[model samples]
Target: MDLIQRFLFEDLDVRGALVQLGPVWRQIQRNRDYPPAVRSLLGEMAAVTAIIAGNLKTPGRITFQLSGHGAVSLLVIDCSETLNLRGFAKSEGPIVGNSISELLGDGRLLLSLDVEGMQQPYQSYVPLEGETIAAVFEHYLQQSEQAPAALFLAADGDNAAGLFLQKLPAADEKDADGWRRVHGLAQTVTPGELLSLDASVLLQRLFHEETLRVFEPKPVRHDYPPDREKISATLRALGREEIESLLADHGEVVVSDDLSNHEYRFSADEARALFDTPPPNLH
Candidate 1:
């Protein structure tokens, strides 16, 4: 089953998270036919997105976006506090690279956290600086959260998984070298182990000697339902003239949301009806 497992070190001020995705990862890629390298990149983002969203203390959503001027132009992944995920990757042409720097050439990574009851989402940006997705996120967490973090992410056509470790404030007070030791142990994890092993068994294999408390696993899934009304409202915003022009040229208005793998096609009559009805009230 696809799930995220959280754990704490009994004698240390450090916590960890393990996320494994099977069905949900495949569902996200159901609509798009990405190149092998691009598919792996998107899968890694999906895994890390789940891990980060699972750690949110409040109800909200988190988004990670990578924008670049390369073969892979954009990569977006959104995950809610409940672990609902949806995302897609946009590319200019055939992708040839396997590393983040190669795929994203001179790009920036943007993180947005929309917390409950907040007027504006919290946002941050950092230049792409790592060879892998895991390294990039590790740098971001260390810089933005001011917590030393180590992340291991891996994915293939079938599954995506990640292991995250963050050293809380004053972690050294509990055990001076605890964070370092844990980080070292975590680096030993192989991509095969991540995709194949069970969370509890994997934790034991990595940190068997440590005093740890493993929590119950929380489920994760792909949950992006088409919002027809919202899509209609968007068409309305484009104005009637634009909609009619599109209909005259193409016979229908088609709006594709690559991220959610949803398509909205409006017949000429349906497109015209949008303006005949009242727009949704903002308040």
Candidate 2:
């Protein structure tokens, strides 16, 4: 199953999140024929978004954006607090290589949060400081969260997985040495192990010696909502003649530019139903 597992060390003031994405990660890239390298990168971003957003207290969505001057110019992944996610990638120029620095030359990473009814979404930007996405985001957490943290991320064509460990602000001096021991263990996780192992097996293998408390898993799904209301309103205003003239060749209505690949293909009856019936919120 695609889920995120939260755990805590009983003897230390530290927390961790383990995320493994299978079907959900595959669904995001289903319609788009992204390059192999680009697909892997997007999978990594999706996993990272889940691990970080798992701790969010408010009801909202978080996005991870990567933009740069390279063959792959942009990649964006959004994950809602409910664990609904959707993303797409845009590539331009020739394909020279697939390494992080190669695909995203001089790139910047942005993490943005759009809370429900918030006047302004909170955003953070970090320069591509590491050769891999995991290293770059590790640096971001260190600077933004102001806490000592470590991460291990891996993705094959089929599955994406990551483990996050962070030391909470501790008041007791006695547990100070626990950080070093726990981080060392976390560093030993191999890419193959991360991508293949289940959450329970992986956690037991990594932290069997430590007192650990694991929580029930929460599922992650792909639920990118399309702007149907806006499209319906525009179609109604245009009337039948104008609307048919506009979509005569294309045979569909584009809700917005953001939905480059997902034009609402409404038949005559479906078109009428869209305006007559209220559309449910995107899950």
lDDT of 2 by residue, 177-221 (tens): 798998999999998898888899999999999999898888988
- Candidate with top TM-score is 1
**Candidate 1 structure, TM-score to reference:** 0.93
lDDT (Cα, tens digit) per residue for candidate 1, span 1-283? 4899999987888999999999999999996888888988899889988888888777689999999888898999999888899999998766786988788888999999999889999998898878888888888888878888988998898999999999998789999999999989999999999999999999999999999999989999898889988899889899999998999999999999887889999898999999998987877
How well does candidate 2 match the true structure, expressed as C-alpha RMSD?
A: 4.1
Tell me each candidate's TM-score: 0.93, 0.83
Candidate 1 — which residues are off by over 4 angstroms? Answer: 276-283
lDDT of 1 at 37: 88
